[model samples]
Target: MPTIIMTKWPVKLDGSVRSKAMAFLQKLSHDDTTPGLHVEPIGGSADDRVRTGRVDQFWRAVMFRLDGNNERHYVIHGVWPHDDAITVARSVSLTVNPINGLPQIEAASPSVASAGATAPAPSALSSESAPAAISPAGSEPAAPSTPAQPAPPSEASPAPAPSEPLLVRLGRTRTELTDRLGLSADIADHALSAPNQDAITELAARHEGWIGMALIGLAVGESIESIVESLELDQPHPSSGSQEADLLEALRRPAARAQFSFIEDQEELRQVIDHGDFGAWRVFLHPMQRRYVEKSYSGPFRLSGGAGTGKTVVLVHRARALARRNPQARIVLTTFTTNLAGALRDGLAQLDARVPQVTGLGDEGIYVAGVDALASAVIRAAGADVGDAVRAVLGEDRSQPNGRTTSAGWREVLDGASTSLPPEIAHESFLAAEYALVVLPNRVTSEAGYRRVRRPGRGLALDRAKRDAVWSLIAAYRAQNRVEGTLDFAEAAAVAAAWLETAGSLADHVLVDEGQDLSPAHWQLLRAVVGDGPDDLFIAEDSHQRIYGPRTVLSRYGIKVVGRSQRLTLNYRTTAQNLRYAMSILEGADYVDLEEQPESTGYRSARSGPAPTIVPADSLSAELDEVAKQVGNWVSAGTEPSSIAVLAGDRFHCERLARGLAERGVAAAHVEREQPPKDRVAVMTMHRAKGTEFAKVVLADTGATSAERDRLESLDGSARADTELRRRSLTYVAATRARDELAVIQREGRRA
Candidate 1:
């Protein structure tokens, strides 16, 4: 069978054109000789391989045809009118990136590439002709002979201030781009000519293949190695010793997979067409993301990136890849919340409907569940109930929660018991953190064990007397839960972990999403279920987006990804304008990943758009009124109503926004647990909005003070700082949910 590649799948189309394109691909894949297809060559094309096929009476498919001895490959570049199709085919040619040696679509004639002026002869730069433009590693870059002016403010300043030099971004020079990394002299000279970061971004927007990616990486202050890694330019091409990879062999690499996909069957082609750009990540992921999904690891592995970098997409694809690689392997895919786990399950199905999924802890297929749900499954698989588990932690008072967290029991104990603990430490946040991080994970049953236990990363220091007071409260809390026969999430997970340790491995591999939200006890439970070997655990998380869950060090929980962790630096979802807005939320905040190192890198979005709008409104009514107007404008501009979302900090505001939309004669639905229906606008809280995206988003604030945001202002010292950071992250999360446009309506009356 011939391979069908969707190169640069275009979403810009009318319904008629979209349908025609899909029909064209469907027929071309199954039988290329169909009468309507009319596949043939374009006479005046710069590249003779260029061909045009009939999509409809008015539309034509501009593509490249490669005929092999056994089969042919159809590479669809775009769908356009007849004249445009011929023009594009004539201008385009397939060639290899001189630096990375990856296949790319080049528009200039091969003569231009061959000329010694624009670039070197394929592999080597003219040794003595082009002077070395940089110094050795670990030293300040040598300045160009002619002094350069300072960069202007408002440039892409994610990495450093605009006052810094741009031609030598991240201190990388022409010699580094050409020799150490990979870039042709012409491209290297072009990047070095850019006046500032803004210029680099503008240059990236116009170019394709490795040129755009390499330029953006330079602007972001990415290291030479990271830029290579980010581009997946380091991928092993079949024609390694030659100038470039063969068309067929190049398609097999992650580099090619970023903009191209090989259709295996008709169903996949249909699904890819149906989802379009929304599902593009599944089919066209950057080589870096594909690396995380396809690469093998000695132990647990971690993948982190800022919002919209396709971490979840990688996780979903990795899950399917793992299942297909080992049919008999028992895999567990889990997260912190039930809603997120459900999202993962839906993602797996959307990725490939044939992925084998099972419910129990069976030694076959993949089991998708929340960590708590997995604990429940583990207990049941061991012929135990929730009430019977957690005996080690709760002792005689141990009981099952019916799957609900007994966290409230801690507050109840505080109200019932008497102590002089500090007000900050007396709060539920402090107490819960102590129990989950120190007590439960350490398995401290008595006050004596708690006193002897070391609190490694706990923010506050507890003296013996203070420890006694905390233990008294803990003892009372356990006593109440013991009598009620209820276990909080931490205790239940602890019990499950203990059981799994004794029962041996219950899962061959485990993949975790939103991993930053899980507690330490949850991590222990996860480690217990999976065997400790190759491909043991795969975690996808972004510390900047961690709105829920604790700050945990995975190595402390025995799931080490220290040397195995990698980050994706290019965002595929949010527009560059909105991405700058989203990143502004974390401007001064310090956040660390599961590895516990300060996040040092920044990500650049692939798309660019208008800057996000911020409206300051006095009342809930005014905010919603503006939101309604914005929604109307978006819909009138051809964006689907179902592709718009209104997000808030809490459920009350979400409901109010939904009601306000209704009063304004607009269709809107309140979303809580599940995704909203496709026919109406969806209104949901920021927390629930995670893992979801829309074409346009309106972040509206009602008069009600959110519990989480209120906590941020109410606390003091380190605790308050942490709460404020998470609050910033929540707004960042809601903002990034917008794929195209975003509007933030601040309720001045509520906070100001």
Candidate 2:
């Protein structure tokens, strides 16, 4: 029996059409090659081979053939009205580009080309090739359309002269091209140096989805580097085995599968045929993501990618795999914030609802919670009373006069120290960094230890006198916290790490998502929880999306990832235009990996959307009005209010905007890294917006107050530059959270 590949069309059908389609699919699943099934041929270009089967008198299912290793595979492209399905079957043409090995599509009929007729509405298959119409068996296809000639480059607009051949011009060998383009070596080499150019061209047409587009772009004078940067290829691994088998397997890739649906077993196929839709995430692993999930590491392993690259997805899957493989294993899924941990728990639940060991802050199986929450839990298990310490800083109960919230106390310290700072130091920022990077992680309790400790990544230098003053400032703050019986996050994390070393391990494996936001103390605690052995740690991180926490290398904290690291370059979320806008904000800046390696490049998105809008207003009030109007527009366009977010630079504006929008009848809620309520627009500070996403985002304020800018400027040397970069990165994070649309609204009037 032949294998059957189902496209995404069944879900698009309804009423009579859907019922008929299901009946036809059931019959095909029973016997795909049965003569009575009536898989009639539709003549077209060889690369666009197709066939049709009747769903009913008015509708037909169009499909293509892929020769698999064990048997032939029939891929159902779509079920359409008889005429539309047949027209698509006969007119479609497919091809792959030689350079990138991605697919492209075009109409094969001369009349359609001459008439400039648009293709039918998009289906999963239409995303790959043109729709074709049925032609009688043995009837010849219509004459191929003539290719359009390019207009000559004018005096003002010039194109580069074709020279040195495309392959020679790229100056990369097969291996370099394969690695850079994220293609298999065979596909990259074949596209560049295939013995028969026509054979390569023919292959391009049959696999025109992502694979064909790359080859076609190369054929049309596009540069390999540019092509590599423009398209998102979820799995760029090279193809192997026979050409037919390789091409067939490529079509089954997670990226291509994302467009169409595919089912392997007959029972599942029947259920899908009967129900018309199967959950999309069950088998949906982009090639890169599959590798990340399935590969085994001998020790600590990390996966990094840009926002929406599915790092968290990999962690969820990996957690499930570990849980299922070892019944005795205890696993923990963690992230920097509670909201992200909640999202992770929800994701893991979807993957395996019966995993038996799912709990928050538990000791065994799979536990999902924030890192700090886990640390506090571990501390409590060790017989420590952590409520007062944790509550003084994080608790929302502000009714008591003696409450010493971390934020309020930190601000007070900054204000008191600012008046007495030496010229070389930015007192507030410098003291905070010293505490986090020096005192907390290193467990430096005395002045001598603080003076001897090395400060890496801190750009500013401090003399002995300055260091003494910083230590005194830190001591003063610690004394205040001690008096209040309150512990800051770092102090708590430090204590948690030490307690874990003595209290014994908490789990067999620890999987961290949003790993980039974790501080050094957090990593130390995570390291102490699991044995240093196989599968001990699996983390997904992206420094480009680091919106909070100090930057620290994992290796420095004993979590080494020297040879066990992967970088995902393709972004599966956010359209190309929105991604480009986000990239432009971080352009020219440098970042490092977990081990301090230079950042990798070639980040690209496979999808496209409208360019981000920047709305300028005469004043702050006008900016708020524009933001509110934009939110209303998105709602009018049918987006859920919960899918929209409005972010600002500080809490005051974030809260004010949420209130302003609520007054305008837009159900808006101010959420700060807490579980966002459904059906209401979320408004939060940029810091709180980290590790979260929305369909549409409105950045309420972009203009920095003159006083704020002046204060930053007063900082000495690169410290000022670092602050600005962090601000820009925060904006970038907010902008990229928008999967479809982004609008930046800011005031423009001069300061008094």
On TM-score, the leading prediction is 1
Give the lowest summed-lDDT range of ten residues in model 2.
133-142
Cα lDDT over the full model 2:
0.64
Best by lDDT: 1
Kindly list the per-residue Cα lDDT of model 1 for residues 58-165, writing each as its tens digit: 778877787754688887776666665666677777665555656666656433221111221322111111111111100011111111112123333345445645
TM, every model: 0.85, 0.71
Worst 10 residues of 1 by lDDT: 132-141
Candidate 1, residue 312: the lDDT equals 75
Model 1: lDDT to the true structure? 0.72
Indicate the TM-score of model 1.
0.85
- Per-residue lDDT of model 2, residues 113-154, tens digit only: 101123355342222211110000000111111111221232
How many angstroms is residue 549 displaced in model 1 relative to the true structure, after the best TM-score fit? 1.4
